[model samples]
Target: MEHQSENKDMNHEFLPMTSVANNTGDQVAPGVFVLTTKIVNVYFIQCSEDPSTYYLVDAGMPKSGDMICEWAEKWFNHPPKAILLTHGHFDHVGAVNDLAEKWQVPVFAHHEEIPYLNGQKDYPKPDPSVNGGLVTKLSPMFPNHGIDLGSRIQPLPEDGTVPGLAGWKWIHTPGHTPGHVSFFRENDRVLIAGDAFITVKQESLYQVMTQKQELNGPPKYFTTDWKLAEKSVQTLAALEPSVAATGHGIPMNGSKLKEGLPHLAQNFNELAVPDHGKYVD
Candidate 1:
């Protein structure tokens, strides 16, 4: 089936923002690979029990379809069985339509995220005035429009089981967006934290460009609900993931993940939530 958005004119344009980590790939865990295209990260997870089967965690930046395909082929020699979305932000789902169409794979997301993915609703605009740096100021240019994935998008299973993935479950970690979710494997404590929390000061153009390893909140300009964001941080921190690959920055683990995550969780308001912003109460 062809992928058609409700808004035929809806489009994602490439942003000028980038980082040193762009185009780099790393294996954060056994069979779990993280690739950064432009800025956001997309994960490739090969099932240990079945070498031939694997899944794409998130689609990367706009016009990144070919890069994602190349990376997948380089590692698995085939397309993913399904595309999993943490949220429907422009950067996260940029290559989704192209990849899904090419591979003929099903796309899954949290039920609440369906609207954003299926063209039923647009995300709230990024708050450019959030107390942040250059990236925050440039937020006005970011796309808040939703794409139309039509019938290709399905709600993630209510049982938390990830489709085609064994030993992994999705956690409803909203606040950045209504249906934002993080994938976690209880046995390994390996987490794909998505934008629930990140490893860079996303609002600062300089830090984002340098790939500084700082555990911070979701991109502030696009984050609408601080209260829910705080809760989401706590939820993931409680997981105590051994290694975390976020939407931005390189993978983090060890004492950093252990100490930093909970610290961010406890001090979310001061550390994550901007003191002043259009979305702040």
Candidate 2:
């Protein structure tokens, strides 16, 4: 799978009047809808037990608080129970502070990510030299700073249970980040695969902007642990998810997803991992 894209300005889509195509607040499963704000994604999940209860997954990019709130109000019938984080990347945690305060809700993350969320640490610098297009080249400018959410943020429970979603489990899919996780529903085999693996070839400019659907690994530039990332992919593939929504690109299902996921798992090093990067051995 190789790309020969015609689009060039993928990151500039967030600019005013840029005419970017958005699939914000689209339901990918019976209860999962992904809210895309530019190149990043946040999810709105409804609990099967109570129609009036829900949770917001990942807060989206900085300054996206208003846009995310607007989408939630327009699409979801009930207020969120809490804010669950897959990880604390700048893009993923951008609007967290604003949303947590406005909703008066607690934010939950893997215990390993607490230091980053509380401004105690920063992720390793992004690898601009990774085998990617403009996105990797420009990643050096992306924020490496952490957000200080104060006492509003807490760790996800260690019992594998998702706060409000009784049937769901938060799998420890670390690699991209030490505490990164993916949410799974065993009965339906549906997955919300934060950045553990995405449905788009994030290194390519056109793929991110066009929202192309390809079962690929995490973003190579930001992923600091290739071996662990590879293991995470295999673990997710083992679940045999019938449908999946990722942090980037479009949600996918059916034969396309079934066949693509296993292929990605089997050949991750060749297809997903970059040959030379700061994070690569």
Candidate 3:
């Protein structure tokens, strides 16, 4: 498979902002739907028996409500039952308040992330001083404030089972953020990996915008601990997920996912780990 391509004219109209309802949202698995936002992906997992009551994972950048609503109307024809957050990153939670208010649904996240989500703790701002690509250099300008969804916020289930998402379990894969988590469906062997493992070098805007697919660890410059990040990758790799849809880039599966995961798990330091960046301690 080609690693990079000049898809300059490739119509990313399917990205949430433009053709939300028109595009056939990518299917990661049997009942999993992926709605691509500006550069990140917001997932919607549907219940086989009860289509109306689905679980939405992550909210894309601010003003993403229209895109999510457009897709939900065409896909579910109703509001989601709940919202499950992987973590409280600004880009991922940007539209949480708007969507929660519109649907009147509860939002659940790990307790460790509450401080960042409740305006009590500020996430480590992106460091433009680190060198990776243009995205890193320009990331300092991105918004980093917490969105107030106090009324809808709730702590994730202590047992790790997401309330409405049956057959799925939350895995605490910290490092990118102290409280970051990932979703895994053991029955189907499908993983909704967040920033714990991105398919592209997320620090590069070009890579994210172009949807390059590579099994890389969390974006190095932003990830706080190299040791923990490696452990997280090894832990997820042990599950041997047949399919994985991450925060950035498209979904990957089968031999490609299986074969690539070990390589990433073993040599994450050399391949995706930054030499000397802001968060490396």
Candidate 4:
């Protein structure tokens, strides 16, 4: 799918004022909504029984709290029931505490991600030395703030089932982070792929800025284990997701996702894996 090139100013207004939906949300799938922030995408899943009860998936960067809350109010008319974290990455969970506290909702994360979320363990510092593109070069500047959400944090259900959203399952798609999980709706074959697979080659700022759509593996410099990462891609490929909305880039579906996914899963090393990087060791 081709997208027209649009320039975003320093104010970060990508869409026009009239086109911007203070409450107009993008329907990623049947009940899933996507609200793209400055850096990351925050998903809002509405509960089937009670529309007011919704789940917020992956809080964006710290600067995104107000934007997120505004969107939430416009869409759901109230705070989210819970905040489900894909992982404890600096960007993904940056505003978790802020949103959770304001809404007084509990945060759910995989057990394996506890250390990083609880501030006990730090991810390997990003290496700007990795040769990729502008995003990789500026990696060292990405904020790595750890907020204390322990008071409201809870472990994800061991069964991989997300409460309130029946018929959906969470898969352990580690390598981006130990506890990173992607939501899958088997019946509709819609996948809420986290960073396990992105539509754009995230290492390249040009691709991200342009919103180029292509199936690619996780960001290399931030990804820790190539072997595990490959397996995770293969695992998702086997599911044969009919539609996917990922952490970066626009939503993708149809023959492109069907055909390109296996190729990416098979040749991930050549397409996205860096030869040498900080996380590789």
Top model number, lDDT: 1
Worst-scoring 10-residue span by lDDT in model 1: 1-10
Q: Pick by TM-score: which candidate is best?
A: 1
**Predicted structure 1: clash tally:** 1
Clashes (backbone N, CA, C under 3 Å), per candidate, total: 1, 0, 0, 0
lDDT of each: 0.86, 0.83, 0.79, 0.77
1-281 in candidate 2: lDDT tens per residue?
A: 01112322222221121212553555667767677888888988778898567899999888899888887777664458999999999889999998999999999999998999998998888889989999988899999877789999889989989876888999999999999999999998889999999978888888778766778899999999999999999999999987777888777777777888899999999999999977898
Clashes of 4: 0
Estimated TM-score for each candidate: 0.92, 0.91, 0.89, 0.89
Q: State the displacement of the C-alpha of residue 185, model 2, in Å, after optimal TM-score superposition.
A: 0.8
Q: What is the descending TM-score order?
A: 1, 2, 3, 4
Greater-TM-score candidate between 3 and 4: 3
Q: Tell me the tens digit of each residue's lDDT in model 4 across 1-281.
A: 01112322222212211122232346656667777776467788767676567799899766788888887877767888899888888778878888888889989888888778777777877777655888988887876545567778888899989977778789999988888889888887878888989887788877776666788888766787778889999999999987777887676776778899999998988886777776665
lDDT for each residue of candidate 1 in 1-281, tens digit (9 for 90 to 100): 11111311112211222355558665667677778898789998777678678899889889999999988877778888999999999999999999999999999999999999998899999998888899989989999999999889999999999976889999999999999999998887889999999998999989887887889999999999989999999999998888888998877877777888999999999999998888898
Which of the predicted structures, 1 or 4, would earn the higher lDDT when compared with the native? 1
Q: Model 2: C-alpha RMSD to truth?
A: 7.8
TM-score of 2: 0.91
Q: Which is superior by TM-score, 1 or 2?
A: 1
Error of 4 at 97 (Å): 0.8
Point out the worst 10-residue segment of candidate 4 by lDDT: 1-10
